[model samples]
Target: MCRSKIFRICLLFSAGYPLFQMTLRLIERTFYYPVSEPVDTFTILDLMFLGIVLAAFVSLYLGREYSDGVIRNKLIIGHSRMSIYLANLLTVTLGAFLMHGIFFLAMFLLGRLYGLPMELGFGELAPAALLGFLFIIAYASIFTMVSMLTASGSVGPVVALIIAFFLMIMGISIYSALSDMYAEIPPELLADPGFNPLASRPKWQQVLFPLLYNALPSSQAMQLMDYVAYAGAAKAGHLSTVVIEPTVFPLLAGTSALYDLLIATFTTAIGILLFRRKDLN
Candidate 1:
């Protein structure tokens, strides 16, 4: 069953990988790709990374749920439900890491083909890989929780993708509101560099929205890619910021890691609890 799951996953990504890579390469050559503009918006990395992450995540969690015929045959002399859930989580996380490994390999090869320098210290690369894997794993767990309410493998990823889409829309809406209110400043209001754009309320405003408006995993992935973009640009002797609409208090990738860990705990615990009550015929 485990081997079947891995095989299916590899097959799915194998078909999808070439198209995404080709598109990215085309975009890079045209120089009309993501992050080329002055206005901040989702970059190509955002879509590619998120698409890969979401696909891998949904495949792993939901795939595991249905792939194991024996596991679903809970009527047999069964193992502990708690053990089942933990096993699923562990398996899903391992799947996420494996998927991430594939993604990074593809990305690095593409980077090399495009003549981009792909150098990084082993220490830096290790943590980055760990962070990316964790992000995907957490995201998969959340979607797995969603799948518990439904019965289809397709349902889990479709719902997650839709929800993720809407999350991006919501972020855009918030960004639009922020832009209209701030980007077009009065000449008298904007001449100073010390003006705080995101400072309407005190710094504590973050706490209020932390739950009200969560950042999408793609946007957060883009946040990391943006840094990679910046570092690449800076290496070329340019220090300009990437055109991602600045969050008044931009959540760095590390900060997103903190959020991922916290959110994963809640979502995964709930999923485990729900799995315990699963009525497998």
Candidate 2:
């Protein structure tokens, strides 16, 4: 995997993209916005691109291994199916982290040069960073599961990328619905007794939208970005226009992290079971 052309290209992207974004943002913040104080430099949303990148890389890597019969050769050499599955999971997860770490390093270095600090302190940042890492693991588990079960290396990437794209679209749709539903009403509308916002929506939508937003990895990523934005704003002693209530920030972050943990665990277990029964022929 390390020697593969795909791996090298991903590494370059992981590092270069963040640097490019940071530079653009810095220029924008300096010339267009012209803030007097340092601003928040990084957010979990910055790493969201990794979803598609990792999906493609993991699927293609596993596909190459499958085509070359490396998986079968490992079994022939006495490695158990479970061991092989876990090994792949670990490798892919590590690769994802390496990419994430590179982005972080690039962002941090650039932010420092531009005199922009992360705004949120260590205590505030740690949990968000940890949750972001968990999201990465969840992404790896999902793509690894899809690729490992697939017989054709070529087919694996297509399936994984489709799933990633679908999840992203679904997440965005849910988020937008929730945002519209919860958006603040005008004072006149609020005073009108007949204008209850919740009255128009079905009960199921009210419950399901929040549940899906917190549960899906892509939605969680979006939520984290909002959380980070709100936190940065609050830490800077400014009013946050972000719709998420600051009081529920901890609750949302905790719930999102829990979902990520559950996703990674569930996907890995199911992948192992399915791979054990998969025929190499």
Candidate 3:
């Protein structure tokens, strides 16, 4: 336990502390919009912070599993790999939850100091706050599962990043399928950018690309951007002036949780079942 503590202290400084610093910078640069109301959706800081936390946890999970042989021999006690996985999950979730709770407290006090009409009512804000916590945790878990399966935890972030690449590629690949179907429509309507979701691609193609994009967990960043914007705008009371809808960000976040669960379960199940039969020699 003493060794685990010392090792974690080092790892936190090496990876996690840098992530927190990045989040601090992100909060300063990206969360600078004028006051409108209290928090509602997410901000760039929120999304980037989530990614930073996810990446940090993934890296460490992989690092720990890789170092497991040494830890077991040195400590004269070791858990089954499943125990290791669960303990890591709990540690990541708890640490992030506590840190974010403190972050929210700091943001609230800062908002109050600035005389912003930020809502502090637990009844009103608790659900949203809880949902955000769950969303990040779910995202982290998916990244962790991927790290364990890849044999190189370092590849976790790259795989998560590929979701963005998938979106760009899938979008271009199906643009032709969409244009061909929409060619029969009125030219003026088809020409309008606002009509593009349906007009740019047939329903099937639209749904297909979204599926491919969703398969990449990082693709959820596109959706979470709306939540971040809403959180900022809500804090500033900018929502009233905005004509656009709230975009159901919570639902989208929930969908991300589901996607991560489905994929992670499959990946971990395969790895654990395989691990039981393997021999390093």
Per-candidate clash tally: 2, 1, 15
| Candidate 1 lDDT tens digits, 1-281 | 34665545664674357447655655765676543332111112323345445644665455556645556665366778777666666766666556566655555455545544443433434444455665675576676667554545666667767766665565555544444655556545554568654466456654443332335555555455555556445545766533333322234555766777776788878877877777764
Superposed on all Cα atoms, the candidates' RMSDs to the truth, in angstroms, are 5.6, 3.6, 7.3
Give the per-residue lDDT of model 3 (tens digit) for 40-128. 33212343345555555555555555545443442246557676555665666565565555555444444444444444344444554
Can you write out model 2's per-residue Cα lDDT over 122-225, one digit (the tens) per residue? 56665776667878888999999999998678899999999999988899898777677657654456445576445667988767776788888888877777
Clashing pairs in 1: 40-243, 40-245
Query: Where does the lowest 10-residue lDDT sum fall in candidate 1?
Result: 37-46
Runs in model 1 lying further than 4 Å from the true structure: 5-69, 113-129, 153-158, 171-195, 201-215, 241-253
Better of 2 and 3 by lDDT: 2
Query: Model 2, residue 179: what's the lDDT?
Result: 71
How does candidate 3 score on lDDT? 0.50
| Global lDDT of each candidate | 0.54, 0.77, 0.50
Residue 47 of model 1, lDDT score: 38
Q: What is the TM-score (0 to 1) of candidate 2?
A: 0.87
Residue 41 accuracy (lDDT) in model 3: 33
Winner of 1 and 2 under TM-score: 2
Model 2, position 119, has a per-residue lDDT of 77
lDDT of 3 at 32: 81
**TM-score top scorer:** 2
